[model samples]
Target: MVTRREWLLASGAVAAALALPARSAFAQPARTVKVAIGQKTIAPNLVNLLIGEGLGYNAAEGFKAQFMTVGGVSNAQVAIDRGDSDISTGVPSFALPILAKGEWGKAIHFYQYTYPYKWDVAVKPESTLTSYEELKGKNIGVPDFAETAFPVTKNVLRSLGLDPDRDVKWTAVGTGVAAGVALQRGAVDALAYYDTGFGQIEGAGIPFKMLPLPKNVPMVGGQFLMALRERIAKDRDLMVGYGRSVAKASVFLAASPRAGARAFLKMYPEAAPRGSSEEDAIKSVLLATARRIKLYDPPYAGAKIGSINPEEFRIEAQMNDMKISSFDAFLTNELIDEINSFDREEIKRQALAYA
Candidate 1:
């Protein structure tokens, strides 16, 4: 016969054993985070996306991205509109016009990074055509007929004193591998390929060079990460957490360039060129990616999720030159407020190690 004290102690021990297993089970459950990819290729972005997945960052934040490359802003917008995808990447310039046409039921703009990420006029390195001026009368391959790529290409051409309408020819090819095929076959004199796509082509032993833009020319508009606004608001904490995560990631990329590159490659093995040291190539890529990252500033520099500035007044002015009056309508950073409230220092610290 046990004393009352011993009886109580035995009961407590039983409860503790039961609770231990429950805690372990809860910790082991895999969370799902559905994200949509705007394109189908593995390039600069795959590393970030992969990091979110491989490192369980997305799961920790309660997300599992269902990545599909619905190539072009118009197509990506339509996917979000139809409820087929939850998030997408699109030119800030084009998103406003699409939303202006009607109220979208889901998907909202949460954040943006003004990385003048490279999407250039690529040609075989052996070719003698050295200047943008030579693009006159050339057949330029575009990923989509209606998307940011063509507009950016045209903007660059005009910046070089070439009339996009009459000076150069445009062709619409599907993105990634398909666009590379067009360039390889000489079906197009120049192709507008993003840095990642360019890397893939280069990795395939195809000798191509991105036509360098004048240092001041903007090839890509400021880009934003868009999701269903209502959904984002409902899960405001998660959305803000993501913003904090990206801010952390951005700062990490800037401060620890080598570590960040390694992290990126680990997340997306396909991001690196075959037979090339992923470590070294990422360093080269980061050197270039860093400049573009600067364009977004604040949220990036301060590692604060929701910070934005009107300094893009210059970029807006550039859009105005394109006769884009609707520019201001879609550039909303209101949602970033939720992200700013969280502690992002650690995430950024971890992410920079990937650089």
Candidate 2:
């Protein structure tokens, strides 16, 4: 029979053992974060995120990525607000209204796909319209009046000394094929859309010339990685990992967009554009990736790949006619320092090695 002293000694030993730092047999597994993209259809920009997942970059950073596709930017924001997703991607234009209404939290821009604007006004190859001035009194087809493309195009026209509301007639035509068709049928004299739209038109055997926006205008549009303020506060490390993975993927894209496209196709073959063969899909992604790559060559005012410039946000707000009490209220660079911490040369090496 055990004595009281022996029982006391046993209890002490058990307590000491419990205090030891031993791995638990039933420890919880690492988490997988769900991320949503703004559009239901995957575009070339999303290919980088896919490449990062396929390459295990996110895993290396200590979490797994589960991508979720939503109907549009508003849906993506709703996913986060409803706690269905932890992160989402979209333009600040989409996020601004949400933030204004207190419907969501801040936007953290991780990808600077273009400066000033991503979309442009384009005319037929043989059309005599040579400049923004020529666009006056002409009908310009845009993706949607409510979308960023419309206001951005209007701003560009304003910078060109034309009143977008009065001098130019704006028509709502859908993107890609629809806008291309409008241009082809003379429904609109020019189409204001992204480079991808131009690619779509040219690939369909139509020739066009892009009307350049003035370089002196402030940077007005780009994409962003966003999360609710609560989520960002609680899961900063996860966001950092996400930023790092995407930064590495951007390097991979810059090195070889074709490889990025291949990885994307391997993961999501269904993302192939409508009516496109696998080869055509790859070509389309390559073309889109090439254009995005140019935006990073100088790296957005020499900042790191994922860094956001406060002044740029001010300009964007002005262009959108958004009134903000503070830029910090809507944007943050908290994760950028960590994302840019990796050795760029090493990132390039790994990117080149991605099969």
Q: Which model scores highest in lDDT? A: 2
How well is each residue in 1-355 modelled by candidate 2, as lDDT tens digits?
A: 1222332333322222211111221322387777776553555656666667777777678776777656455556556555666787656665554444454444444444344446778887788987888888999998775456776677677766788899989898876667788888889999888665566566666677887666775576676777777777888888888888888877777777777877777666765777898889888777656666666433454577777776766666666566766766666777778877888798778667866
The residue pairs found clashing in candidate 2 are: none
lDDT of each candidate versus the true structure? 0.56, 0.67
The window of 10 residues in a row where model 2 has the poorest summed lDDT is 16-25
Q: List, residue by residue over 1-355, the lDDT tens digit for candidate 1.
A: 1122332333322222211010111223254433444454445643443344444455566654445554445555555555555565655455543344443235566576445545678887677777788889889998776555776677677766788899888998766567778888898888885565555555455667767676777534556666677667677666665655565556555556566666666645555555667565675456434444454454345544334443443453464353344434444577666555545567556755542
- Model 2 vs. true fold: TM: 0.81
